[model samples]
Every structure is written in C-alpha cells, then in structure tokens.
Target: MNIRQDDPAAPHVSGLLAFHLEELRGVMGEHAFALDASGLSSPDVTFWTAWREDELAGFAALKHLGAGLGEVKSMRAAPSARGSGVGRALMDHVIAEARQRGYRELYLETGTAPLHEPAIGLYRRSGFVNCAAFADYQPSPHNQFMVLAL
Candidate 1:
C-alpha cells in the first residue's frame, strides 16, 4: 500500500469521507468528534490517504496542537479495506509523521460503544493508554481518551 499526503476536498476521497462521518454520527450522535472536510482542511491539520494501486484504501489525519503535542483525527479504513491492514498502515503513517514533526506525545478521542472495539484494540496495540480528557474536550462517559508518549 502507498500512503501519501492528501486533500480532504479531493473528489476521490468524498465517498469514504462521507461514509466515515455518517458512521461516526450514527454511533456518537451529538458527541461525534470526527472532522468534516472543512474541519480537516484547517491550517493545523495534515491529512493522508492510503492507496492500493488504483484504489483508495483508507485515510487518517494529524492535528498539531502546539507545544510538541499532536492529535490523531479522522482515521478510517474503507469497508472494502477493513481487516486487510489498511488501518494499521494508516496509523503507522500518522505516528511516524508525528514523530517526524518532533511531537513529544500523540493523543486521540474515540467512542466507547461496542462498534468502536476494533479501533480501540488497534490503538491499544499501538501503545496508546487511556487518559483523562485533554485539549477542549469535556469528560463524558461516551468518550474514551488515549495518549502515546513519543
């Protein structure tokens, strides 16, 4: 798989992005934290897409939160790409990029629903440990916060 920097507004990414947002909204309702295209396009966020030859496999983003801190955002593997290592590849790419940028830590917020177990497992396997809320997020039973010290 080839992972490269991407534009959230690119036509090729619209379908998966919409699916990702819709799924998150369905699962988390008002608490969904996944970014829409406009949000991902912010100056502090960097997005990337994983491709398998001609097909878009998955996407993830990293947000710079100042002071050597970074947050993982908008991570999703296409339905067709799930269980094929796409998520792992995208995650590895994000973590590597954060380290490259000199971040001392990486953080993320995800849902606590059963549907989120797979992702939570992935994060755990990647060295993230549960933590209290950071940044502007408030404490919520529906939210799980995690961090990895780089």
Candidate 2:
C-alpha cells in the first residue's frame, strides 16, 4: 500500500472525496457532517490518498483546529477497498500525521447508527474514546464524538 499527502483539490482526489461526501449525505440525510471540497483545501488541513498497486483504495484528511488540537475529517474507504485494510491504514496514517503536526489531541465526529459501528470500532482500536463535542460541533443525537490524546 502506498500512502502520500496530496492536494484534495486535484481531479482524482477530489472526485473520490466527493463520492465520500455524497455517501455520508446518503447515510446521514440532512445531518451529513463531511467537509466540502473547498473546506478540505483550507490551509490548516492535510489531505492524504492511499493506493494499492494502481487502485485508489481511499483517502482521509486532518484538520488543524488550533489550540494543539486536530480533527479527523473525510475518512472513507472505497467500496471495492472495504475489508482490505484500507481504512485501518488510512487511520493509522492520520493518527501519526496528527502527532507529527504537534497536536496534543485529535478528535472526530461520526454517526451513532449501526452503519457506523465499524468506524467506531476502528477509532476505539486506535485509542480514541467517546467525548463531548469540540470545536464548532454541537451535541446531537446523530453524532458521536471521540478523542485521542497524542
């Protein structure tokens, strides 16, 4: 597997990331929480793309939220790449990258639905624990917040 930082605005990355956003919208309906294309390109955000051979496995991003904190955003494994370790690899990379950026902690918001269990398990295995909302996010029945001290 090859993982590298890339411009989320690039055609290929943008298209795949857009698919991820759309998938979230479908799953969460009016409560989808993904950042849009331009938001991914913000100065404080770092986007990463993963590939196995010539296949685009998936992508994830880290958003610096100031005060020694960072947020995990837009983590998605392509449908074909599910169960292939793409999500785990991408998550490990994000965690490491957040540490490298000097963040004291990393946080994320995911859904509480059964459809989100796999992701919750992923974060749990990665050392994240459930927490109250952070940044601009407000507490909501549809959202589950998690945090990892780095």
Candidate 3:
C-alpha cells in the first residue's frame, strides 16, 4: 500500500474523518474526542491514507507533540482490509515519515478494549514500548499509552 497526504476532496478523506470522529467518540466517549489530542483538525497535523491498486485501505495521522515527540491519530482500517496488513502499512508509512522529519519518538493513546489489541500489538512489534500518556493527555481508565524511539 502507498500512503499519501489527505486531500479534503478525495473520497477517502472527504468522509473518512467524519467516520472516525464518530468511531473515536464511541471508543473513548465525548470527553476524549473533545480533547482532540488526536489533532485531526490541526493544520499542522499530517493525515495519510493507505492505497493499494485503486482502493483506499486505511488511514493514520501524526500529531506533533512539540518535544520531538509524535502521536498516532485516527488509525483505522476498512473492515474488508483488516487482518490484511493494511493497518501495518499505514503505520510504517507514518513512522518512516516521522523519522525522515527528525521526530525522536512516537507515541499513541488507544482504547483499552479487545478490539484495540491488534493495533497495540502492531505498535509493539514495530518497536514501541508501553508508556505514560504524553503531551496534554492525562491518565484515563479507558486509554493506554505507548512510545517508540525513532
């Protein structure tokens, strides 16, 4: 899969954020989405979608934490694309871009649910270690944090 910057007009990005907005809320509830630590709307944040052939498979975003740290945001793979390595491809793309841009480490906060284990595992196998929440995030019973060196 290939990763590309999100284009608001693209069928992928056009509705993708709206979809994740709802899903994220469902996963973490209203309080967390309001934080937007995910930075989905920040102009400085980078949104990328994975594409294979002519189809968009999944999406991920990187949010700058302003201390050589980065956060993973909006990581989701299409139902048909799950378990097919689409999520990993998106993650690898973001990690490579982060390294290229000199980010010293990457971090993320995800829901503590069985549905999230695969994503957590993906990060673990990619070299990330469990960590306390970074940036402005406070500890949450619903969320788990992780970090990785660049």
Identify the candidate with maximal TM-score: 1
Off by over 4 Å in 1: none
The CA lDDT at 3 in model 3 is: 77
lDDT of 2 by residue, 45-109 (tens): 98888998988889999999999899999898888998999999999999988888899999999
Clashing pairs in 2: none
Model 1, position 30, has a per-residue lDDT of 86
Candidate 3, poorest ten consecutive residues by summed lDDT: 30-39
RMSD of 2: 1.2
* Residue 34 lDDT, candidate 2, scale 0-100: 88
lDDT of each: 0.95, 0.89, 0.76
Model 1 accuracy (lDDT, Cα): 0.95
Pick by lDDT: which candidate is best?
1
TM-score of each: 0.98, 0.94, 0.86
Q: What is the lDDT of residue 100 in candidate 2?
A: 88
Worst 10 residues of 2 by lDDT: 14-23
Candidate 2 segments exceeding 4 Å error: none
